[model samples]
Target: MKSVNFKKKLTRLFFVLLGVTLVYQTGRTFFLKQEWQARNCAYEMVKLLFPDAWDRACDQYGLFCFNGSEKPMQKCTGVVESGSIILIHGLDEPGLIFEPLALALHRKGYLVLFFFYPDDQRIDASSRLLFNNLSSLSLAGPVVLVGHSMGGLVARHMLVDPVIDYAGARARTKVPEISDLIMVGTPNHGAFLSRFRLFMEIREQCLLASDHRWHRLSGFIDGTGAAGIDLLPQSEFMRHLNSLPYPGDVHCHMIAGHIFPFPVNMPEQFQMTGNQTLEGLLLSEKNYFLSVLGKAGLLIGDGLVSINSSVPFNVPVTLVKGNHKTMLANCFSGSSRIPPAIPVILDILEL
Candidate 1:
């Protein structure tokens, strides 16, 4: 009788423990789902307000934004001022991203040329088109090329095009000649954030975890294959891209974003040490190593882009406070809560 009673007790205990575990697991899953939904909702709101900005991001080519249409191009109706400045935004970002800076530059008596390119096509095509348009207009004066992220790369393509003969091109322009190149949060070196397994998983989770009905949006993923390749650093692409020599006649400067303080709950891939919180990790050399290491070793960066990754070689560097996503999110606004670092880049350039 005693033996039978013991067996019955053990069976009851097993079922009780199993029930508790299931409840905990279910609750955890539910919490994660809720968090992801909230974030997606926020990003979606940003997308709505800045569709053109996001849509104009560089696709496969290192070109300015343009529709791949064969129609005769419309001449820029907007006339250039003496000290005109051209603005280029990064991959998946829009020209509006530079609105604050654009207004500032305008106040300084500088006209701004904002270019938009499709994220679905090669960047070179857009570059050729931008060149053709400029050639037709013969824009000449002192030009300042200001770009954020991939825009900087596109600007490099323009300033260094051998066919244009850097010096001769400047002499024949109808618009201002590009004299200075300012890149804000530009990933001249390439992104390390793309190599981490955890980073990819988290991105998948953020986009795929939510059933918030945004997956059906027209450019939600924007050329599934194109999106992934653009995010990753291609050695072949990089060699070709970096091989384009920097034009000696122009001055190049880059501003990098660095968020000294980070959230505690940030992903493990961003953590500097296995034992430290994200905030703690940002305060040490370990974080820098992660940023400067091999392709997969970038553990610390501007939320989305690594620090070393943003350095355009030999350009003067400026550091700001914010993460990659923060540049576009406008954290001060309730509807847009991104950081204010890259935006600050615009301010510096305008000054």
Candidate 2:
């Protein structure tokens, strides 16, 4: 009788503690700026109640075998003319983001292939997966790799470090006969936006949830992962990657976005006053600071990457008038105005 009473007391204590934890977590999530945090927190509570919820969601999205047999690539059905063009998307991309560009390339008689990966994984891991997928495919003629944002880093990794040695010294060679590598708004140095990766993950989850096929996994609890860490400018991964020489055979080009065209100009009134008073000196210093800040803003190309970051190692860069997101074809609105990068991409591929 005493043992039974003890067990009952313990059970009650557990319930009370659990309730407190839930309440605290809920409160914290609500206060967070990013809505995804709250959404994910609620999903966690539901998942705890229904252990099979995660599996059900994964199944609904056909992500049950996400990184397994479910081929990491989707080839567009069409006649091949200008060879195979592999379009690699960036961080947090749910694969559908490439639809507009893929369709455009497909319409141009190019065998367009979309390479999809679990973007939250390590950059090297994604690159290796790409290498494996490419190995399986018997790509005929020249293969042009077009990577956007972080995807460019993945492509570069595969090109620079393609050899994968298996057991007993069996090594796989790099993907051969590459024509050109066109990076669209790729952060060659690093992306400042990576610091706010939680927001990015949330944004991506929202994009995934909007699609019928991916709505189930809207509550998926994956963070930015190592890829986000590696995207930092001073990360060891970035340092090592930058140190490696780009593949000599592959021709590299960069298409950078310049959202702010006009240079910032300080007002004439802010100019230094020759008065020798301390107040005058302070005012002159403030004006100098403002001038420097204006120059820095201009360097922040596309709002996420700096102009210097976009054009690393002296790769020829073409500046287009649009922000990072707008440079790509408008997938949602079906805007009549062509995206600035599309024409430039087409022109480069033609050559």
Candidate 3:
């Protein structure tokens, strides 16, 4: 008839103006998430009245502490202190940036638990809370794992689950303790700004709406396993953290970041493809070694680790100042300049 009733009145006026612009952008994202939860509850009451004054740089840098209790073979303030270090911050961060690298590994005496997870959950409940706190804690020898940025993929699911106390020792006989891991600025390989956050999710907020792995990490960093390491198995959180198997002789490392044009500059082809150095972009296979340092000279990092991924597996990595969130928020804060990575974790755990 008359142009089919004016194209059904312009397709019901374009879905009624797209349903009133999606209800005024979901009521302005619920009042901007209630004003960012009232400004993080007034920045946790001014960080409990001005704390973080180099909180004794974790006892001049040695670190130590365990404490977890509520009954269970008590006595855990660093089981006869000597070897123990655990810190896994990232994703929304806070837990006092490992209190000055756990007071410098509790002043060289070691033992520094300092925990906290559930940064909006996933990665299988944060790798079952790091394999139930490393098979119900008591570790004091080889255990040294650190994280930052999805807490280094939840400390690589304690080396890809050779067995980590499955939901309370599922039927016992599966205890993994975790040897050594360190990852900062993470991204394993798949965060090239996630396609500018999925093109700002077509605006009006809901920018990837709290991550469903941003379009499966923009289709595994645009496929072909090169950077975006083929989006680690379409990420069920990096395919259960790339199904482990790299723990042989532990001591793995992959610290990356760059702040060049921006994404905070850590991309020399993502530090040469996370140090796997291109050839088919290696992710893991027990073979470890990747150290790419920086400080704005080689396109800075540490604001999230960028000198080709804060190298340190086969050792040799330095050059600090600050970035990657001002190296855990306080390398002597003036709100970012440099000087703090707790003196490079006390010169890389001094040995």
Q: Among these predicted structures, which one has the highest TM-score? A: 2
* Tens digit per residue, CA lDDT, model 3, 191-228: 43322222322321232233222333222111111211
Error of 1 at 320 (Å): 0.3
Clashing pairs in 2: none
1-351, model 2: which lDDT tens digit per residue? 999999999999999988986685456434433433444355456557666655554332211111112344323322333487878888877666556676677678776766766676668777877776666555556788889999899888877863642111112333336778999889988875775566677778877766644544443433225676677776666888898777776789888877664334322112122242212222233466665654564477788877657765545667787787778867456578778888888998888
Off by over 4 Å in 2: 1-82, 162-176, 215-224, 264-294
Worst 10 residues of 3 by lDDT: 221-230
**Each model's lDDT:** 0.52, 0.65, 0.46
Ranked by TM-score, the better of candidates 1 and 3 is 1
Q: How close is candidate 3 to the true structure, as a TM-score?
A: 0.26
Name the runs in model 3 displaced over 4 angstroms.
1-83, 86-103, 112-145, 149-151, 154-156, 159-184, 188-190, 193-322, 325-351
The top-ranked prediction according to lDDT is 2
TM-score of 1: 0.56
What's the distance in Å from true for residue 150, model 3? 7.7
User: In model 1, where is the ten-residue run with the lowest total lDDT?
Assistant: 59-68
